[model samples]
Target: MSSFLGRGWSFPPRFDPRTKEAVMVADETDIAESLHILFSTNPGERVMLPNYGCDLRRMVFEEANEQTVTEIKELMRKAILFYEPRIVLNRIEAQLVDPLNGKLEIALDYTVRGTNSRHNLVYPFYLHQATHPVRA
Candidate 1:
């Protein structure tokens, strides 16, 4: 457990006034946080690391349909396989929350490589254009 503890530090550390130290998160929480960071980041957005993110954003502007869903799933599968070596992907589900609103919902089921512990994560992304008009 102590060996795993080193890898369980939370992404956004929480302060503990009594100990004057950051609170550590459980192992599952740490893995979840790492996945969130990986999915949220866009390729080329990271400094000097241009190929670091998933390609889901590229299909966001396209119509939400079967083709879009398939593409998104492939992108997710590739990204996770390439970037996250600690987890083995079990399944990926993607769909539009509302075609009119252009919101997409994605769920990923994975197992931690060495431990074989299963975990699932769902993420919502907005793909619609701004409703309000912008003044020049």
Candidate 2:
């Protein structure tokens, strides 16, 4: 029983030396395609990503913030160009909090992204959708 549990298949001696030559590296096009395949415009558990050198920090938007529709759209545009997120949803949330536990108030929620590891077989794709509004 012990032998059977430990026994496993072995590669041929001639092919023993596994080289990195066979590994196919991903390029810009490959990454974009992978993103498309992973994220859908409409779905569940949409992902949030960190791009533009931004870290994965908690986001909280204050209602008093002077953010306009145009600004939000512009930010979305830039994000689309840079990270190529699937799309931005029509809904947005607003709140005020100290994410870093500092005295500053932030105006934003979370944004999703696709991959973390460069060598990951599947790149992560982000999807942004406005969450459903709750009734009082």
Candidate 3:
């Protein structure tokens, strides 16, 4: 049942030394990782999927207030509605962790569609981003 959730390469790309194959994640773990990727990306990050993300990068300059929380939740809702067809979202919550540090904890509660399994992923968001990124 969970097979419908699908599997993908792990973020940052790990590999097994013996097989020399990329590490993959599946089931609820895959979903959680996908959520992280979706939130981490900006709309134009992917050239093919121009409208694919929640635009968290743009929120870096936003004040960590109620409106910001509302906006973040809405963005998550829209991203999930458009990209993720495997889960039914239960609720989204953004808790201000530290305004001075510009951080928020975003919790996403959802149920897997084919398996009827409930799961939650808590993602820590930081509004403070480094200016002038150094290309490595």
Candidate 4:
């Protein structure tokens, strides 16, 4: 977690394969619910709120510790590029595990959607050393 705490974050190129100018985040309802919870927990960080189209602006969130600022900003840029979503919901969930070692972890989930879609797409990711996070 220390490694993740200080590094800049980025996703590889070719994140989306769709050609319609928009891509739904995912088809999972539970993921949507989780994203809702994450958003509700942090409202100020939501730089781009959803609307009716794909021409949405990117958003960035500054972490409390300021250590993951680069990672959070990168998250915003990637969300904009991959989904071109109407909104960018940025959130950080943190918990303390070992006080002696100062081991903590943060989770970031972005809810992005395509135009003319019925459901929202939830792309969730968490950071940890040696384990890849899941996103769609």
Which candidate achieves the best TM-score against the true structure? 3
The order of the candidates by lDDT, greatest first, is: 3, 1, 4, 2
Candidate 1 error regions (>4 Å): 2-26, 129-136
RMSD in order of candidates:
5.7, 17.6, 3.3, 14.4
Q: Tell me the TM-score of each prediction against the true structure.
A: 0.76, 0.21, 0.90, 0.26
**Comparison by lDDT, 3 against 4, better one:** 3
Please name the candidate that would achieve the greatest lDDT relative to the true structure.
3
Candidate 1 lDDT trough over 10 residues, lowest sum: 127-136
The number of clashing residue pairs in each candidate reads: 0, 11, 0, 0
Decide which is better by TM-score, 3 or 4.
3
lDDT of 4 by residue, 1-136 (tens): 1221122212121334566333233333333443333322333444574432221112122222345534444543444444333435455454444434333343444443432234434333233333223443
Which scores better on TM-score, 1 or 2? 1
**Model 1, global lDDT:** 0.73
The order by descending TM-score is: 3, 1, 4, 2
Model 3 alpha-carbon drift over 4 Å, by segment: 131-136
In angstroms, give how far residue 85 of model 3 lies from its true place: 0.7
True-vs-predicted CA distance for residue 93, candidate 2, Å: 2.4
